[model samples]
Target: MNDDELVNRLKEIIIEEEIDIIIVGEPVTLAGYASEQTQKSREFAQLLEKYLTVPVKLFDERLTSRRADAATLGATMPTRNRDELAAMFLLQDYLDKQKSNNF
Candidate 1:
């Protein structure tokens, strides 16, 4: 979907789920350098911030995919499931830092 469609869908989900904040995963290199994908994620987060009423924050998502892969070792899983697992790891990392007052 395009940006407009994504924003509209996010709006619906926000209202439906009573979402107060949005945590966007910022994919960066292991060395903490920005890549093309990092720039894209930053731009997307900016777009969400501009269009959504809720606050949008970007959190480091380094190693999330690898962690997800390790978690599902020797198992056959769909790409969508692996992506969802990576998202879960990203969110959990964000929440952990937030809980510790480190973020």
Candidate 2:
């Protein structure tokens, strides 16, 4: 979704669900530099922050889709949304990082 569509969709979700912080996936180049897509994500996050009351953070999304594909390679029931799976893993990684930072 474009930033506008995403913000609109998130507005609906925010009204319906209790949310604290937002984590955005920043897909960097393999060399750890920001790519065009990463810049786009950063800009979207910036725009999102302007509309949101909660904090928004960028998390590295290196190989998340690949990992998601690997994880669900053998699934036969029905194809799950790979994007959602990647988001789940991304959130888990962010949460884990936050937890460790407390130590």
The estimated TM-scores of all candidates read: 0.94, 0.84
Best by TM-score: 1
**What TM-score number comes out for model 2?**
0.84
lDDT values of the candidates? Answer: 0.94, 0.87
Pairs of colliding residues, candidate 2: none
On residues 11-102, what C-alpha lDDT tens digit does candidate 1 reach at each position? Answer: 99999999999999998899999999999999999999999999999999999999999999948899999999999999999889998996
Off by over 4 Å in 1: none
RMSD per model, one decimal: 1.5, 2.6
lDDT of 2 by residue, 1-103 (tens): 7867878899888778988889999999878998899999999899989988888999999988777888888464333588888889999999899899999
Cα error, candidate 1, residue 86 (Å):
0.3
Report how far residue 38 has shifted in candidate 1, in Å.
0.4
| Model 2 poorest ten-residue lDDT run | 73-82
Q: Candidate 2: what lDDT?
A: 0.87
